[model samples]
Target: MKRFQKAAGQWLPKMAKLRGVTAAVVASVALSGCGVVNHMVYKTTGDVLQGFSRNHTVPYLLNTDDLAMGCAMSEATTPLLMSFGRVTNEPDQIAVMLYLSAAGCADEQAREHELTGLAALGDMDGDAAEDAMIRQKRAHALAAKRYFRSWQHHNAYYGEPGTGECPDFDDDLDEFIYMAGLLSGLQALNAEIQSTSAIGVPKNVGSMVGRATSCLDNEKWWGAPMALRATIWAMIPGAMPEGENAFERLEMSDRQGEQAGVRLSHVFHAISAMNKGDNERLRDVIRRHAESIEETPSNEDWAFVDAMSTQLIVAISDRMWVENNGHRTPLGQLGTFWDDEQEDVETMDLDDLL
Candidate 1:
């Protein structure tokens, strides 16, 4: 609690200076409004404040691909940012939800960097390898932390199944932000669990995530909501209900995202395939991504997000190449296999290594 207070104190000054307002002042305003009206206002304000966090924080952090920046941005924005949710009077629930969702998204990149770094450390010195391992463990740990935190908040806003404390969004932005949080959080949680050293993945996580964000309309969220649902379906055994088609839903999301011009749903499918250890499916998705890039060269909105997603896919390709042949993916390997037409490059394999 003391630590929380101290950290909150530091940001309070900046919050006042930049926004010319303080959460304490907002907290004092509860005396003047009806309970319901005040609750909506608080949640709406918190929802708006998170945009500033996403805008001012995410681009710079993604460009440099820095882990510290991801954590720093989380700390820097969350305190004063939570105040918006606080003022809204939803038991500080929305504030908690906003903070975790944004932080979890930021941490997703951190986890990916660690995964790639582990692969990149191949053939390094003992000391350097140990250091890389240390960093990777910590990175996964942070990723797990943010994801679980988001999970807790999701439960808070909407209680466990059959016990209804449902979330009602204020607008499109509100719903999008909420679902984005769930998407990132669930993905992060999966990565953390795979790391086997991640802290705090829920034991009942499968059930928790299976039914999460059920309120999201597919077309409304540009297929992201379904993409997330498909991910949980594909990754968790028996999680998909009888007669439900996970792949079809994933493909549906892919089409919707492509039509929406966001294309993030593909990333979800690719990541899911990777998790399931279906190399053929992974390759298929990667090929599709490359072909898509070939067809539509530029992504005007979410350029960096889409680029980073591709980078991770490339990192996966790099892993395959490293394990198969002694290097990262060949420069021309994506969308096309290296062994197909590139005669100069030997079609190396296990036989060559053995």
Candidate 2:
């Protein structure tokens, strides 16, 4: 039987591609006939996926090939990207385990354990449905917000006037900034969702879906940051004068792009379903997002971003699959990332770069 585990945190470009050979091998195994021979292949796939987290605590060294792949745009920007890689990689690995199980590649026992983990985390005293959804969203939001802060530092080129030397500033940093904006918007929405009195299930889920889908249909990528904000406000229910004019500001930004919008739309759809108590919809969103992830032939950088995003989605939504199939676990219900910062006291200095 094949074993599975969950991927935790965000995924960066460096860890996005598992070598073309590795990806090809996984795809081959997945497509092969299911029997004793294929079983062996499945087992190997599980092992390779799980191995990603064996040494998560160490700093990842960028290889010569990685540099050749355009990872080093600037010194300040490079380290931040590396940090993002580590932060995102943790949760991403945990997500991978769930995805494998949901795909029917994991053993029955493992599936059961995965469900138990998700339930434990979100059930809040073994309730029928998850009660900790809001709390869980907050934590995810915080991590994303922190990452966004770092990304902004790196994107100093885009910073407002009078802003001092951005230690991590560079031209290519816009991509990172755009990505961070999506994550931050999600975090804010999560915060708003948690503040609702609607218990485990909420009516605003549908509204959120509508808003997110509206953005997608309109092909408004940059507007997503505000869409999420609007959704969060709507979720608050009858809170007169929705604060922070997210919609107007998001509409004003002229940095729309296909990749960012696609990613945001897919994620919003998944979350909307989960909040609506429609696990089936969530499942479909997951599958659709997974399929839409394409490796572009012209731009290798965009391909890396898409691949990494797909990997993260697979890992994060894998647990939802288990829950829909009657498997409930703490791990399955809440996507979690372990933060080493809480345990360490070392402060990083940025004065030298300035």
Best model per lDDT? 1
Candidate 2 lDDT, 48-134, residue by residue in tens: 433433233111221112321222222223333333333233223222222221222112223334445566655455553343444
lDDT of 1 by residue, 123-163 (tens): 55556656655666665666576666665665565454323
The pairs that clash in candidate 1 are: 42-88
Candidate 2 residues lying further than 4 Å off, grouped into runs, are: 1-116, 119-172, 175-182, 185-262, 294-299, 326-354
In order, candidate lDDTs are 0.63, 0.38
Q: Each prediction's TM-score against the native?
A: 0.64, 0.35
Give the Cα error of residue 73 in candidate 2, in Å: 15
Error of model 1, residue 318, in angstroms = 3.3
- RMSD values for the candidates in order, in angstroms, are 15.0, 28.1
Model 2: what TM-score? 0.35
Instruction: Report the lDDT of model 2 for residue 141.
Output: 39
